[model samples]
Target: MSAELDLSPEVPEPTLLESLLYNGFFLGAIVQLLCILAVIKPTSNWYEQV
Candidate 1:
């Protein structure tokens, strides 16, 4: 069984780094959200280009 929203193709095999990057995006997103909620995320005032 898998998550219902997964639309990615079912590859016969996946490289470790590929899996790591996939999970990293999700993990990093969660951490970023937490930081934002805690008001610890850097502000746009600190970076003009961003």
Candidate 2:
């Protein structure tokens, strides 16, 4: 019971490196999706530009 009541007040938050890593992976997924779409439809201007 004492241990449960003694929890630290500090809350875990994402660090800059963690945020960067998450965004990098997210961007990578979007790029991969675009590439796949481009393969399926080569004539679209958006796909061509990518």
The candidate scoring highest on lDDT is 2
Q: Worst 10-residue stretch by lDDT in candidate 1?
A: 41-50
In model 2, which runs have C-alpha deviations exceeding 4 angstroms?
Answer: 1-11, 44-50
lDDT of each residue in 1-50, candidate 2, tens digit only:
45557567898899999999999999999999999998998874776687
The TM-score of candidate 2 is 0.62
Q: Pick the candidate with the highest TM-score.
A: 2
lDDT for position 4 in model 1: 75
| Number of clashes found in candidate 1 | 0
